[model samples]
Target: MTIDTALPVAAVMAAVPVRDAAVAKRFYERLLGATPDDSPMPGLRQWNLGDGVLQVMVDPERAGGGLATLMLDDLAAAAEGVRVRGVSLDIAQGEVVTAVARVVDPDGNAITLVQA
Candidate 1:
């Protein structure tokens, strides 16, 4: 079997589902160490990272069902930055990546950081 297709995605905006926007925003703000760069609609908040965006949206039934991974040049520094901002995460060695750490938002959504 053969198929021809094209994915011309210019950029990506990951949507993180949450139960409470306010609470989730606060948690993400600290974890990312900045306020949201945009909010396109109610119950939604976004942060621009590099060439992409990460957004949190309110969805009670879908809360805690989101996950995103971020690759960084310095995993230790990134982990330390979040920790100092009041987000607790533990770093560990992994085969796929040099170092990795994970943190969960108040609503249970997780964001994984890895050394690239």
Candidate 2:
């Protein structure tokens, strides 16, 4: 039961449940402006999100059951990009002066973009 904080940890993958993997894949590609890194399994798509991996998979029972918050270098630019792709965002209040914009995927999974 001892932990080693000094050891390097492996990358983390955030999973987002979707009703239709194909639809989610297209939405995410437009939203992130990149194709999936790989599809290790059927009905599963993975994207490299800098610090971590974003996995979108089909799971009828758990569709729309996850939330991810991404920190961006420029909030305005990111918002505009998504907007151009026909994605609407809700600019909400943040804890500090940071700007936060939120959007939901086809399956209703929430993705929040933040700029500090």
Each prediction's whole-model lDDT (CA): 0.89, 0.86
The whole-model C-alpha lDDT of candidate 2 against the native structure comes to: 0.86
Q: Name the best candidate (by TM-score).
A: 1
lDDT tens digits by residue: candidate 1, 4-115: 5888789888889999989998999999899999999999999999888998999999999899987789988877898899888899999989999988888888899889
On residues 1-116, what C-alpha lDDT tens digit does candidate 2 reach at each position? 98888969677788999998779988999999889999999999999887898899889999988898788888887878888987877776688847899888988899888987
How many clashes (backbone atoms < 3 Å, residues ≥3 apart in a chain or on different chains) does model 1 have?
0
Clashing residue pairs in candidate 1 are none
Kindly give the stretch of ten consecutive residues in candidate 2 with the minimal lDDT sum. Answer: 88-97
Query: Candidate 1: TM-score?
Result: 0.92
Candidate No. with top lDDT: 1
